[model samples]
Every structure is written in C-alpha cells, then in structure tokens.
Target: MRKTCLDMVYELAKADDRIVFIGSDLGAGTLSEMQKNMPERFFMEGVSEANIIGMAAGLAMDGFIPYVNTISTFITRRCYEQIAIDLCLHNLPVKLIANGGGLVYAPLGPTHLAIEDIAIMRSLPNMNIVSPSDAEEMKRFMNQSKEIKGPVYIRLAKGGDEIVSDPKNGFKFGESILIKDVGEVLIVSSGITTKEAIYASEELSKEGIKAGVLHMHTIKPFDYKSIIKYSQKVKLIVSVEEHIKNNGLGSAIGDVLNDNCYHKMPKLIKLGIPDQFPDKYGTQEDLLKYYSLDSKSIYESVLGFIKSKGLKAA
Candidate 1:
C-alpha cells in the first residue's frame, strides 16, 4: 500500500508541475525514478518531521502541492503542532502520506506504533483522513486526492493486503463503501480491519447469521448517512478499526448514531486496540491476535454479541 501511494505521487507529479515530493529519512532508492527525473521537485530531508510540515506548508503557500512522506507516529505525534498550525489552519493543498499506520511497526514497540494516528488527525479542523484497504484502493484514492482543497492524512497499512476493494463500487472521497448489504448485523470497518470484518461476516453466514460490511476508507467527513441507512435495517452495528477505541472510527460512528438514530439505534460494539501500550513485541498479525482484532476473534465476538442480545437473522 505504501509503495502504491508513493508511486502514485511520482505519477501525479509527472503531469502536474505543482506537485512536489518530500521524504523524511527515507531510503536512498525510495522514489528513485522521481528523484532522478524531477530533481527540483523531489526533496529528501533528514529526520526532522516538524520542519518538513512547515516546509510543506511554505511550499503550499507558494502554490505548490507538497506530498510529505514519513512514518505515521513521527508525522502525527512529533509534529502535531506544526501540522495543526501550518497546514490545517491554512487549509493548504498538502498531502501527508503516512507510512506504517496502526500496528505495522509492532515489532518496534509503542514508540513506533501508530494506534492513535486516526484519532489525532481526525481532531484537526480542515484535515481529511483516508485509510485505503489495499493497493488498488490507494491508486483510486491518490488519483482523486489532488482535487481536495485541504490537508489530507493518508493512512497506509503494510503492503500486500488482500484486495477486497472493487472499482465497480466507485471511489469517492468522504463516502463510505458498502461491501455487503445490511443484514441482521453491519460491520463498519476501516483500513486493514475491513479484511478481517469481511472474513468474520462470511464466517457468520455459514452459521445461519446474516452480516454486512461497510468500508469507511475515509474517516473524517464520515458517511453518517450510510450509518443511518444501515442502522435502520440491522439489529447490531459493529465498528472495527486498527486504532484505539476512543475518538477513533467507532467513536465517529457512535456520534452519528447518537445524533440521528436516537429512536431506532441498534446495538453498537467497538472492536479495536486497548487504551494502554502493548506489553509484548511481535509482528503485526501477532499483535492483532493478541488484541483480539483478528478474523476469528471478530467472528467470535460478533456471535457472542448476537447471542447475548438474542438477535436472530432477519
């Protein structure tokens, strides 16, 4: 997914002279073609995340659309003030291509993990948050990202995720994609968690249960209409994300449910990382299992919720 995003940046730069690429302490060969071809537009900065946000802001002020790339934690946590003041406050046309979103860096421990990135970015005004499910979706998103007028936080998972996104569904920024129609339960998910939710929905189907999957690739400017539409038909709504439980995808959906579905709100279960830092070190998949965010765990949790609520297939 990260490669697709950077490659698309390079591709977009070829046609649009206003587009520029900035990398922070990345490898020498990260975007070799772009650096070799467009030397003036390609910038490889040091480990200064804060400075890069300011630099991108300046470039945006000068009518250049800068695309800054770096690890998610450093970009969001280390340079939050700059991001908020420089790009978001000005509503510049800068794109923040964040790598290693969620637990992709689980082996490196808490300092590197980006479990709260979504929540942090969502808080900033005029900042758009996008989490593509796979490489193909990233391509579709990057194609349209240039048209958005404000700053965008592109959350990228580790590469080689399952390609569950279909072009037939159509790609629109800030619009939720309904992978499966609403049934007895609706699984609202973003980023790679959508894959697990799809698997869980399939597993539930075999046991005489009907489940649906709604992929919210764009977090901010959420699709509240979709939640209200699906909530009316389902007995339960499950929001699954790779970030922490508070102020993340689930919380965004919860706000929508509270505001619009007051009379006919369905049961909502938020499945995500806990509030504390991880106590152990492992790969991304290992950490996902430890946090009970895997497919089997999601399936079991949904089934248990249904049984406890006495919800039958509709």
Candidate 2:
C-alpha cells in the first residue's frame, strides 16, 4: 500500500508542478527518485515534525498542494495543534501520508504505536479520514484526494493481502463495501484488520454462519445509514480494528445505532487491543495472537459471543 501510494503521488507530481512533497525524515531510499526529479518541490525537514506541517500549510497557502509523510504517531499526535491551527484552519488540501498505523510497530514498543490516531483525527472538524484496505483502494483514494479541498489523512499498510475490492468497483470517498452475503452476523472493520475479518468470515462459513464483512475505508463522515441497515438485519454486529476500542470504529458504529433509534439492536462486539501499554517485546503477528485478533480466535470468539447471547445463526 505504501509503494502504491508513493507511485501514484509521484505520477501526479510529474504532470503538475504544484504538487509538493514533504517528509519528516522517512523513506529516504524509496523517495530518492522523487527528490532527484523535483528538488524544488520536495522538502526534507529534520526531526521537527511540527514545523513540517507548518511549512506544508504555508506552501498550500501559496497555491501548492503539499503532501506530508511521517510516522503515524509523529504526524497526528506530535503536530496536532499545528494541523488544527495552521492547516485545517485554512481548509488546506494537505494530504497526510501516515505509515505504521495502529499496532504495526509492535516490536518498537508503545511509543511507536499509533493506537489512537483515528480517534484523535476524527475529532477535528474539517479532517477527512481514509483507511484503504489494500493497494487498489489506496490508488483510488489518492485520485480522490486531488478533488477534496481540506485536510485528508490517508492510512497505509504493508501489502500482500487478497484483493477484496476490484479495480472496476465504483469508488467513492466516504462509502463502505459490503463484501459477502448480507447475513445476521455483520463484521465491520478498517485498515489491515479487514484482512483478519475476511479470514474469520471464511472460517465461520464452515460452521454454517453466513458472516457479512463491511470494509469501512472511511472513518469520519461515516456511512451511518448503511451501518444501521446492517445492524437491523444482523443478529450480531462485530467491529474489528487494529486501533483501540474506545473512540474507534466500534464506538462510532455504536453512536449510529443510538441515533437511528434501534433500541433492540443486535449485540455489538468491539474487538481490538485493550487500553494498556505492552510490557514485553514481540512481532506484529505475535501481538495479534496475544490479543486474540487472529483468524481462529476471532471466529471462535464471535461464535461464543453469539451463543452466549442466546441468538440463533442466520
């Protein structure tokens, strides 16, 4: 996903000189061609991440579409005030290319982990959040970023997942994809967690549980209507993500259920990491297994949760 995003953005920069790229000390090897080609438009600000956003804001004010790239924690958490006051205040079209989103940096410890970035960015007024499931969605979202006139956060991941979305699928900015049979068990997820949900759905099919997977690429301005419709039909709704449960996708869907007046709604289960720092070092896959976010654990947990609720499978 990261390579696809950079490839498309570099292509956009070639035809138009107005596209400026800014990086806060990252991906030096991959961006060598871009830096050599467009030296004037590319800026390599040192470790000062806050200043990078400010510079991007200034460049945007001067008729440049500045795209900032950095680690997830540094981009949102470190320079939030700058984003709010400098960029979002003017509604600048600054594309945020954030890598290592969620718990992708499990071995680096909690400081490098961005478990709450989605929740933090969703609170900003004019921020547009896009969590693409794979490389195909990343390319589509990059094309859509050109049309949007405000701050946009584009979440990226390491590639090599199944292509759940086709290139011919109608692409929109703030839409959701319902990927399988619309049954009584609906699984809503974003980012790489979408892949985990897909695996769990396939496992559930073996038990005669027709699980539905909704890949929510967009977080802010969520498609509440679709969420409520799925919630009504499903006997159980499970939200899976790599982010913290609080203020993440799960909480957002819960709010939609409340507003739509679905008092007797299906049981909603939030699956993700708990609210605590990690004590030991491990790989991303190990952390997932420890958190019970792998395919087998997720499938078993969903079945157990549903059975405990005394709900019949659809």
Candidate 3:
C-alpha cells in the first residue's frame, strides 16, 4: 500500500509541475526515482517534522502541492501544532503520507505505535482522514487527493495486504462502501481492520447470523449519510477499527447516532483496542489478536454482543 501511494504521487508529479515531494528523516533510496527525476521539487530533510509542516504550507501557498512522508507518530504528534495551525488552519493542499499506521510498528513498542493518529487529526477542522483497505484503494484515494481541498492524512498499512476493495463500487471521499448490504447487524470499519470485518461477516453468515459489512475508508468528513442510512436498517451496529475506542471511529459513530438518530438509534457496539498502551513486543497481527482484533475474536464479540441484547442470532 505504501509503495502504491508513493508511485501514485510520482505519477501525479509527472503530469503536474505544481506537485512536490518532501520527506522528513526518511531512509535512503526512499522515492529515489522522484528525486532523480525532479531534484528541484523533491526534498528529503533531517529529523525536523515541525519544520517540514511549515515548509509544506509555504510550498502550498506558492501553488505547489507537497506530499510529505514520515513516521505516523512523529508527523501527527511531534508537529501537531504546525499541522493544525499551518496545514489545517490555513487549509493547505498538503498530503501527509503517514507510514506504519496503527500497530504496524508494534515490534518497536508503544512509542512507535500510532494507535490514536486518526483521533488526533480528526479533531482539527479541514483535515481529511483516509485509511484505504489495500494498495488498489490507495491508488484510487491518491488519484483523488490532487483535487481534494484541505490537508489530507493518509494512513498507510503494512505492504502486501489483500485487495478487498473493488473499483466497480466506486471510491468516493466521505462516502461509505456497502460491502455486503444491510443485514441483522452491520460491521462498520476502515483501514486494514476492514479485512477482519469482512472475514467475520462471512464466518457469522455460515453460522446463520446475518451480518453486513460497511467499509468507511474516509474517516474525517465522517460519512454521516451512510452511517445513518445503514444504522437504521439493522438491529445492532458494530464498529471495528485498529484505533482506540476513544476519539476514534467508534466514538465518531456514536456521536452521529446520538445527534441524528435520537432514541431511534439502534444498539451500537464498538470493538477496538482498549485505552491502554501496548507494552508487549510482537508482530502486528499478534498484537491485534492479543487485543481481540482478529477475525475469530471479532466474530465472537459481535455474536456475543448480539445475544446479550436478547436478540436471536439468525
């Protein structure tokens, strides 16, 4: 997914002279082709994330669309003030390509983990958040980013994830994809977690529990339209995300249901990492399984949540 995003950036730069590439403290040979092709527009600076934000903002003001790449934790947490003030506040056309989002860096411990990046960026107005399901969707999202106004935070998952998104369904920003249509319960998810949601939905169906999956790739402009439409069709709504329960997809969906659904809101259940730092060092999948983010665990949790509401499985 990471490679596809950068490749798309390079492709976009080829046709658009106004496009620029900037990286803060990235490894060697990162986007080397773009650097070789457009040395004047490509920049790779040392570990100053804050300075890069200001630089991107200035470049944007000069009619250049700068795509900034860096570790998720550093770009969002380290230079949050600059991001909020310079990029979002001014509504610059800077694209933030966040590397190793969620537990992708779990082996490096909690310090490198950006489990709350979406929450941090979602708070800022004019900031668009997107977590594509796979590399194919990343390509589609990046193609749209050029025309999308305001700052964009593109959360990248580990490379080589399964491609679950289809071009036929259409990838629209701030829109939701109805993966399996509305059923007894709806599974709303984004990012790589959507893969798990799809898996759990299929498994649940085999056991006579009709489950529907809704993949919300765009988080920030929070697809309130789809959330309300799908939430009304099911008896229970289950939100799954790789982020924490607080200030993440779950919280955002709850706010929507309360404000829009009123008492007509269905029973909503949020599944995600608890509000605690990951102290264990392991692979990304291992950490997710430990936190009950795996397919089996999610299926069980959703099924359990359904039965607990005195509802039938089928």
| lDDT of the candidates, in the order given | 0.93, 0.84, 0.91
Show the lowest summed lDDT stretch of 10 residues, model 2.
157-166
Error of 3 at 231 (Å): 1.3
Candidate 1's C-alpha runs over 4 A off are none
Residue pairs in collision within model 3: none
Which regions of candidate 3 fall more than 4 Å away from where they truly are? none
Candidate 1: lDDT over CA atoms? 0.93
What is the per-residue lDDT of model 2 for residues 1-314, given as tens digits with 9 covering 90 to 100?
Answer: 88888787788899888898888878767677888988998787899989999899988899899888888888989999998888878889999999888877888998988888998998888988889888888888888777788989887766565566767665688888887766879889888778888899998988778899998998977989889888878888889878888888999998998788467688788888788876555877787788777777779878997688776665
* Residue-wise C-alpha lDDT for candidate 3, range 1-314, written one tens digit per residue: 99899889899999999999999878788889999989998999989999999999999999999999999999999999999999998999999999999999989998899999999999999999999999999998888899988999999998999999989988998898999866788989999999999999999998778888999999989999988988788888888889888899999999999999986788888888889998788899998898888888889987897778777767
Superposition error at 48 for model 1 (Å): 0.7
Q: Tens digits of per-residue lDDT for model 1 on 102-141?
A: 9998889999999999999999999999999999999999
Error of 1 at 68 (Å): 0.3
Per-model TM values vs. the true structure: 0.98, 0.95, 0.98
Q: Which scores higher on TM-score, 2 or 3?
A: 3
lDDT score for candidate 2 against the true structure: 0.84
